[model samples]
Target: MTNWNATDLPDLTGRTAIVTGANSGLGIATTEALARAGARVVLAVRDPERGRAAARAVQGSTEVRRLDLADLASVREFAESWTGELDLLINNAGVMAIPESQTKDGFETQFGTNHLGHFALTNLLLPHVTGRVVTVSSGAHRRTKGIRFDNPNLTGEYSPWSAYAQSKLANLLFTLELQRRLAASGSPVRALAAHPGWAATNLQGRSGSAVLNKLMAIGNRFIAQDNHAGALPTLYAATQDLPGASYVGPDGPGEMRGGPALVGRTAAASDPAAAKRLWTLSEELTGVTFPAKVKTPK
Candidate 1:
């Protein structure tokens, strides 16, 4: 899909989308584009006031919902309150390479929020999903070897970049397994992944290193694309008629910036065995399992 952009999104009338972390950065841009395309967009953020503020800027049917991916109780509450069909679920909220911290559930922050949180949420709401599930991954997934199953939380040793990379890799693997399950269940839903590829967002500022943050600030200005451009791949994956488990990213060099297109992932990300193992671990950690039957919306 050369030269494809958010402006090329199909008419999304009557659709409903929930974009986590929709209060800022690529999340907000994605919400705006989907709303502009006539979808009823939900700004799912941890902060209700800020979510409302973001929602006010959107032009279509919109609502603000509090959802803290770092907390499992909040995720369950959000999913329990849902009703009817959900056409799109954009798992966009995530923490980057920040200080090594634990989520409320005691899991590593990056893995907990970026992968497990969305993993639990998606399975909880799978029955209502009629269209697609798009989880935002990252090119940084290539930096790490694979999931640290022995000590996923990095209990004894923790590196910010490694944690982030593991979480991003989990994103792709989750998509892969989710699609496999959906297909096996004979469901119409699809699961896809996308990456912004060096998008200029406030996420870069919280790497927990002053020197690195400053360097990233400089790179954000020169090397990164704007939020709208960064959001193209997510939008494309969310709305396009692509294959299950497809990964979309920019078409530019190194997938840093350009139009949306199918992109490759590391072998670790493409391994079905690893995908299944991660899925099992995710369900065990979150206490959320894939639904035995997915109810399709008529």
Candidate 2:
């Protein structure tokens, strides 16, 4: 907690880290920071060429691999093929505020790509994820009612913004519940969640929806901080003296955006009961269980 900025953090020299969506924006910046800090970083992305380019930019040991969260089959393949120990797993890859669609598995596109895919991938890689798992949830999560276990895929009427918010809430819920189960089972791996605090990333680009696009454009033009700054909170969560289920983000004004550092807030994202319920629902949906993991706290 000693002014825990990315540069002030621990050396990840011998650690192996996997960062999803490492090809661009906050993900790319996060990958670069970790690599620079001496971690052997694996660039997991949906685009191979982009991933390789990203891998080349990193300053340390780097590997580029394909990981399409839109396709559960691909997520499974990527996780299974990846072997060996993992010191950090950054579930940073995500799709936001997009048109209504579905994943290869027919789940609502946002929920599938943002939550379930990461859920399954984390489980598949559990044997390797022996150190920490940092799920990148968002402040947007504060806007949602929480994970819709009753209809996670959004089979009925849907709103893209609400869907994205729900997915992000799931991200936090996943992190909290994962830690609870790990503690119960006596595993040492810590689970943490982080947010970018409205940074200016390519992911911040305008969406198909006119109103949302206008809002993004305004943010990008006015308040959004650069990607490197946005990545700090994540970096803090991944390597610092973190507690289980901690939330980290920007240390700037209103946390809208700024330098990588440990900041705090406990909203609906910190609700324990909601997190546990979501955990059980995720395991049921993914058909994957943490073998060493125990029951989530009541």
Candidate 3:
């Protein structure tokens, strides 16, 4: 995986993929690449017009669908309306270190949108997934200790960076437990995670601090990679024939920017006990449970 790029993607003819937040940033780049490889992609976004605009730029088969991950009702609607096999689910949409806010379900915005949203969506669509589920995590996961189970929403003691970190950590733990369940159920589907080093995107402009946003803008110009480069890890994790629970990131120094490769996570991210606990909490929070057995794709 030294120099793997989007052009290296396998022929995805006849496959179908749903990419959350596919209207912009890494999500759009991923959608373009997959579509170019002959996959029928769905740009699942909160805004249908923007999704359509983005889809128009793509050269292959694509459709736009509304999906507000911040709401459980929307998540259920998106899943319940699904009709056939889903080859890949790219859980790529997320909020960064923005001001503390609650999702429509009243959970912390970062944790809810980044982790719980994908958690619920994944479980709800598990039976239809034939290949893999790729969730986009971040290196910022190292900033926090771990999930705040006692008060996951960080009710009164909320820090934007810390909250974002917790949600990212949750992404890894979710993958671990998801892979475990898939294996135990004798399913061929895999659960994987990826991070886009430091890609320049509009996500930095909404950090809720003018000074921080300006600083990130400067960094975006000089220190970060482009959308295509930043999207490599996600593409690698989604398409490669890697092992379940594999985490992919840039191969550059500090994993900031480079080609995709298997990367290491913190000990907290690798904790099976924490993974199990988080899975239980996620089920309780989302009221979505893993199916007893995932149907094998025929």
Candidate 4:
């Protein structure tokens, strides 16, 4: 809690990390910081060229691998091709406020890529994961009332912002429920969540609204923090001695931009019933159930 920042990261000599969406923004910063700490970082990005460039920009051991969170097959392929123990799995890839669209698997875009995709990737790679699973949620989660399990895809009446809020909320729910299961199974692996607050990232440009993107660009210049600053909370969550289900974010006004600190989530994000329901739904949707060890508590 001493104004944790990237420079404070511990030496990760033998640690290995896989960071999704590592080509730019907070993902790139997280990847670079982890690499600088001596971790062999994998830049899991959708674009191989961009991933390679990003790998070049960083100053430590790094590799590039293609991963499209919107495509579950890509997620499985990445998981299947991995050959060793993983010390960190940073679920950092995501799209925000994008126009209504379905992933290759047909689920709504934001929920599919941000939550379900990471859900499948984490479970498939869970066996390889020896340390932690750090998922990136968003402060936008406060926008929605709660998860609508009955219509999680929002196929009925689609609002981009609403879908994004649900996806971010699902992120926290996934972290909490995953930790419960990991503890029940007596696994050493822990699940944690973090958010970058309002940072200038390519996520805004990909949302498919030119006007909104322009507005956000201007806002980023004036109000948002830089990507490196945004990545601090994630690095803190990944490296800090935090409990399972802990959430980290910036410490600035309204938790928007500053040093890293543990932040609060909406009450709806802590609903155990909703988390369980979403977990079951994720398993069914992805056809990737986590291996059972100790029975889940009733």
Candidate 5:
């Protein structure tokens, strides 16, 4: 298939989009593109100041809202405070290989913030949303053997990379499961997953190893693509009329780094059994059930 990109998006004049971790980097680029295409974008950021500045830099109007992915209560609070229809939701904020930490909810940082937090947020916001959603994942997901249902929090020896990998895989699983539920419930909204390849983002700021951190630091000085270029896949996933549950990444190289292009594939990403297991576990853990009214529109 030819690498797909969205240079001209469908008009989204009256739509409202909420993008998490959108204060800077790829999420900011996604916000810019979405706002430019006519949607009223919300920068869901951890820091309000950074988010406000980011909103100002984007091409279209935007609002800055606080959201700490590590805090379950904050997620619930945000969802509870929100009202009315939501056209797009982009789960874009995440952390990479960092030393072990826990959120306010007592969950491990990587799985807790990256996967569990998003999981709770999406579920809590599900009823109010009436359009498409794009979940940001990573190719590193393929590097993981699979998710550990027994210990998703990595209570054992925690390798930051593996933790990040598992979280990304969760993103894919969440996207697929969400779409299945939407189709089953007859909702018009869609769920899609995307990756930025190897764009230069601040995620590496907290590398677990000094050596790896040094290498990444040196690499960003030359090879890593800009945040704008890295945001393409996410923007495409959020705005395109593509099929639900599809994965988007760079179309160039080993899908390491490039513009917003449809690329990358993983058999594990499409494992129905794994997705269903994750879904069940997620619903149980979050105490949020999928919408039961999914039926095809007449």
Candidate 6:
């Protein structure tokens, strides 16, 4: 993988990709990279005007589509209206360490938007997806033990970081289980996961406090990598010939910033039992199930 980078992505002449939250940050970077490699990329965003504007910035073929991950109706609407084959689906949109809030579905904001929403979207669009699914997780997934199945929404007492960590852990778990199901069905489609590792992006401002947002901005200026650099792992996970369920991230000190490389996840993130349990819960919560067959454990 020497000299591996976005510039090295294979020709995607007939490929089509959908990138959620493609209006900015790593999403935009991922979109541009794919587009430049000759893929038709869909910029799926909550704001149509912004998505159109972001689509204009890409050098190659692109389109803009309305998608609000916080709303299940919107997720279904986006999937229902889509047509044709999808070579890639990048579940890139997500909220960060925000104050306790609920999505329109009454689920916790971070967990709902970051995990459940994408879970539903991927399942809904699976038939259209022929190539791969790349989910953006986080190094912060190590901050938590596992999904809070008993109280996923953290209804009683909530910590912003804890919720975010749980959501990220779910991202990895979903990838693992999705790959398992796809393989069980004898499908070629792969599911992979990646983390940005402290990239500087507008995501920092999502937290509820303006003062904290300002502090994050200042701190990121000195510590985080640019969005393009932070996006390398995602680009790698999306286009690379890696094995199914591989986790990609920066290869640097503390995985903060560097070139893309295969990375490790917490043991809890690798727990097949937890992944299966979460997958069952996700299907119940989202009301969307994959066509792929999943073997029940003995």
lDDT of each: 0.94, 0.83, 0.95, 0.91, 0.83, 0.93
Q: Which tens-of-lDDT digit does each residue in 224-276 have in candidate 5?
A: 87887788888888877789988988877878776566665577778878999
| Index of the highest-lDDT prediction | 3
List where candidate 6 sits over 4 angstroms from the true fold: 1-3, 292-298
Error of 2 at 129 (Å): 2.0
lDDT of candidate 4 vs native? 0.91
Tens digits of per-residue lDDT for model 3, 15-48 = 9999999999999999999999999999999999
What's the residue-level lDDT of 10 in candidate 3? 93
The predicted structure with the larger TM-score, 2 or 3, is 3
Q: TM-score, each model?
A: 0.98, 0.92, 0.98, 0.96, 0.93, 0.96
Candidate 1, residue 178: the lDDT equals 93
User: Over 4 Å off in model 4, which ranges?
Assistant: 293-298
Query: Model 1, residue 266: what's the lDDT?
Result: 92
Ten contiguous residues minimizing lDDT sum, candidate 6: 289-298
Which portions of model 5 miss their true places by more than 4 Å? 1-7, 292-298
TM-score, candidate 5, is 0.93
lDDT by residue for model 2 over 1-298, one digit each (tens)?
2344567757888999999999999999999899888999999999999899878877889998999988878988998898778889999989887878888878898888888889989888877777789999888887776677788877776887789899998898888888887887777889898999888888755368777787887987798878887888888888878789888877678778666555654467778998888878877766767666422223
User: lDDT per residue, candidate 4, 1-298, as tens digits?
Assistant: 3467788999999999999999999999999899999999999999999899879989999999989888999999999999888999999999999889999999999999999999999998888788899999999999999988889899879999999999999999999999999997988788999999899998887667888888998989999999999999899999989999999998888988989899999999998888999999999999999876422223
Report model 3's TM-score to 2 decimal places. Answer: 0.98
Worst 10 residues of 2 by lDDT: 289-298
* Candidate 6 all-Cα RMSD: 3.1
Q: Locate the minimum summed-lDDT window of 10 residues in model 5.
A: 289-298
